[model samples]
Target: MANTRAAWARSHAKLDSDTIADAIRPLVEADPSIKVKSIITEVQSRFNYTVSYRKAWLTKQKSVVKVFGDWKVSYQTLPVWLKAMTAKMPRSRVQIKTLPVYRESEEVQGVRVLHRVFWSFYPCIVAFRHCKPLVQVDGTHLYRKYKGALLVAIAQDGNQNIVPVAFAIVEGETADAWEFFLTNLRRYVVTIDGVGIISDRHNSIDAAIARSNGYSRTEQEYNKNYQRLQERGEAYMHWCDEIGVDRWVLAFDGGHRWGHMMTNLVECINSVMKGARNLPVTAIVRFTFYRLNELFTRKSAEAHEHVRNGFTYSEFATKRVEESFRRAGSIVVNRFDRRNEVFEVREMPDGSIYTINLAQRHCDCGHFQVERLPCRHVLACCANQRLDWQVYVHDVYKMSKICKVYRGEFVPMGDPSTWAPYEGAKVIANWTLRRTIKGRPKSTRYLNEMYSRDMRGSRRCTTCGKEGHSRSRCPQHAGPSSTGGQS
Candidate 1:
């Protein structure tokens, strides 16, 4: 009996990913994020044999293909999918650039591979018109079978709602790729002039801005801040010079940037969707479509509800205005302009005097013109002059405009069977850009000096009772010390 069992064990068929994946396709369709361990358990329960981790991983990947379609076929069918999207939603912009396929040194005729593609939905393009006149651009890497970068351009609404206006999947953050995205963003999505773009001081970004185009501090204040940095070290000042002040300093930003200095808005979007990067190229597109559709639906409903409730501004804008109004009561306004449009405002007690020029839209405290909202000083000036203050609030803050942001309506791209027949050539994936790194994929993100900076000087020497050197490096740690720092 023992011999028979051993023979049967030796003779049992080994499970390949295709067979396991076929069995798990239904499970994957139910929940795409099902784990490999669960898959291994499922195999053991059904086949009475356990699979190795690698086999389970391979099977899970195969299940992804089965549920979402083949990665290779996804690349081939991408052009059809994009065409269908445009046909369903006219005026939506989609641009795809392809490179000729090369084998060794020779180019293959009629065969092309995807180089980069940028897209902006019609709703998002229109929504930007009502958003703040500033855009923040950011880039993140994609993982798994594909090698590339996802570049995004995002805007902020009066309610501080993040509006993703444009996106591109590109080869990498190369200068050429940035140029393509920047030019397309300006030409298609951000059509208005005088709109500013905020990004990290990448040389690529600098180059892109030269082709395309906040901080709202005063020049004198900026000069003083720079002087303090210079006193600390020349290297500090040199670093500031390397990254031009105009890019970050509000006062020097030419009034185009609305005092925004961080690409954190774009990063926030990227971080929330970090896990989605592992999806196949076509799945990535579908994922973005569904996510944005969800965003627009929820936001549009909220906008309508807010308007119905009699709120004339966004929740965030309304809160800001109310706070300014509360502080305005404590301010004393002195007339400056003969027409009573400008005034000198002094807050009670020790607060400094601020020059509020209603006609010129200038507030020395740097809030009125910067945000286009009536600051406390501006509100005080208006109150003292008996001028209507609501006019000072930018039109972008009005509920009617915020409602227009999502009113364009995202037309759902239904079943492919319902899509019009596509006659265009297939989009081929660049075989050269395929990921080749072996072993369990290492995290592409790396910790930098900033991540560990806080650890510096945090180590305490046990014997010396000091917060500099560690116990191992302490002078008295190993030299006849009977007690530790606490002792």
Candidate 2:
């Protein structure tokens, strides 16, 4: 066997000394115990390297191990062996398995398909600034019982955290829906100053605010904002005047469609309330915001950061309010009215009259709520009508929400190559289950079964086959006393 092995090694050991050292470099660093001999042994197991004859050949070239402890030759020889072996090694490609997609089911209803939302849904600074006390509002269809759809709006605090501020899951996204949203919005807004509301631009906003009699102090404030539209030469202001409610339109920018514009605020809320979108109606009603709170909890860091800053809402607190003031003249708004399950787009006489049906919920212009993005027709209507085009649109996106789902929290485990050995080991000296067998009450199934078997219920040594004697404490062992027993 020795002769045959030597013959095989002699034939295969085609490496020079330098190749050996390189092959063992990683092994020696990974484990300090690994020396030249260890590397040679590993290589010998994997390949028939003729180290014996090569030793002398290396010595003539001043590369052989002179003394037993002289490891330099071993180091130099390793690189040579590795160089030859590396060339000889066959390369094989590996295929990776596809990750399983977790199918949607009842248990994971509110789970989002994309990324988890760690914050409140206020996509734009305008929405964030204007809609304070961040509200998590959502809507669903209720066409079976009523002709309209239901919209639920809830308020949240600085932490992207939520509270049930106000909710109106109504019949349709009409003036009635907007009225409910505004009524709840106003009720919530009155509690704070510089109140900003976040909502999708359902035409109801125009109608709800329009129908108010300039009736109360809140109504008067609303009408005052609306009346500003007229003072600024907005085309929709004339419609408001005709309806005896012209005083309520807070004019948006000119030439922007409401649907395209309001998406910022709506999308933000949509992200946070994502999983709830396809959920059963009852579940949405019960724990919609509750589940949202759980998602926010995962973002404890951001919440803490906001709390540290006094919750001074970054969404809008830093905005240049005057910039909005400067752009008012270029904006326009086309007013709409809910008529017989449809919407009537009331534009200037020079402009066209397009119909937006809230009941069937289709706009003659066709961009009412289907695509969810605003159409140019809406923009044209907005421009020709002189509505604040900005209000019809949503806000700009935030950096944090746009990131990948797994980013921000979990970074890859730091390079294992650079990690040092752990400095300390947890010492569990004498761990043992203290509970008694029969006299004592039953604790667990394992313990109960042990007692039933008429055993003291302690672990025994595997080597000695004796109870109370662990493998470390076997009397047959002729070493120092061992410590502790297994449970």
Candidate 3:
């Protein structure tokens, strides 16, 4: 029995990369972070063989590349992959921009170059047509050779489901790149007036939005007036003037921006694609396609299920309506006219009066105006007038509208070999964007004032248990040795 076991171990130890990769491909795909030791143990249990740690690690590396494709050769396949996607789904749009090698410019001569690329799938476009006009845009860094930035534009459906509309791969998060992305997005994705864009106060994004004529003049003037009343310094006021309050501030954006104040939705998309960022550009795009396909399939099914259950609105909207009804009891309604379309609701607890205009679907409190849902005041007025509050709710929140957004089917890109030839110049990573320094790359995120922590608050020292200083800077902790033996 011992001799047989030894023979089995020896046979397993001799397992080649291809054989080991085939065994672990499913495991890797399921959990990309699976350890080498786990793989070795699994191989030992399944095949009655033992493999070294180094061998297992090497096998896992090769297997990942095999399954996901080599990062080095991934960029060359992007055009073809996009072409196949567009063929399968004709409504899908893809644009690629490449920088030509110029002999006159010594800086860019004889280097791998692909400047930027943008793509928007058909289902996402169709879905956004039924969603709110608000969109959130943000960028995240890619991890791999020939590093670049991944720009994402996302919107929220009536059901509060995040719908990704467009994606772009740019050289970096510069003004030019953002402008290109916004230009493509405006032309192909969100070709509608009164669209609200939410993002962090990134200078590049502000410049891009300004150049694209993304906001209306009314929004600009509203922001200027709003900022003029603030106690912010002249420099901050000037900066706000340059960027325009309508670009980032929700209050000054009139009714176009809805209530979205930040690009958190786009950040969520970045987190979803965290694992794929380390892969090649083509693999990253492929991963996005598959992930989105999965999302659409699952969300569509969920929407259908909700509708089948006879839900009038989404679960979130339903809950909000119920909450408004509960609060409606304390609100006393007074009609302004006989039409009953306009009224004033006075809250008994605070004696604050809010005007509810059913015709405009608005309230003085701003909730009804921004969310397009009946506020507590509106609900109270509707109750007093024997009117249906549901009529005042926006069409986008209705179950029918939510269902329409996800009804479009996602067409599959059959096979790579079947893809038509892409005769464009072989796209490669711009080496300028690649990190030269060794250690793990660092990533930073910009946070709006609402999300940012108040570091100006008093801090306590860990050692002395006092406020206004840290442990390292605590005066009470100063030792006699530091006083040159004076103690």
What TM-score does each of the candidates earn? 0.78, 0.25, 0.75
Which scores better on lDDT, 2 or 3? Answer: 3
lDDT of 3 by residue, 1-487 (tens): 5345434534444477779999899987766557788999988898776777777877877777887888657777888788888989999889898876555666454344678999999898888899998899999887656667899999989888899989998988899999999999999989998888877656454443333333223344444544543444465456556876656554456777677655768889888877677677887788879888988899889988988999989888899999989888998889999998889888989898877788877677777877888889888988898998888888899889988888878877876687787776676766677778543335476767765447456776654566777756755456546667664
lDDT of 3: 0.77
For each of the candidates, the C-alpha root-mean-square deviation to the true structure, in angstroms, is 14.6, 27.2, 15.0
TM-score of 1: 0.78
For model 1, the stretches where C-alpha displacement exceeds 4 angstroms are: 1-56, 102-109, 202-216, 442-487
> Whose lDDT is higher: candidate 1's or candidate 3's?
1
Off by over 4 Å in 2: 1-138, 142-148, 154-164, 168-237, 240-263, 271-277, 298-300, 306-487
**Model 1 lDDT, residue 42, Cα:** 95
In the range 217-260, model 2's lDDT, one tens digit per residue, is 22344457666656656665665556443222222211122212
| Candidate achieving the largest TM-score | 1
lDDT of every predicted structure (CA atoms): 0.80, 0.37, 0.77
Q: Lowest summed-lDDT stretch of 10 residues in model 2?
A: 90-99
**TM-score result, candidate 2:** 0.25
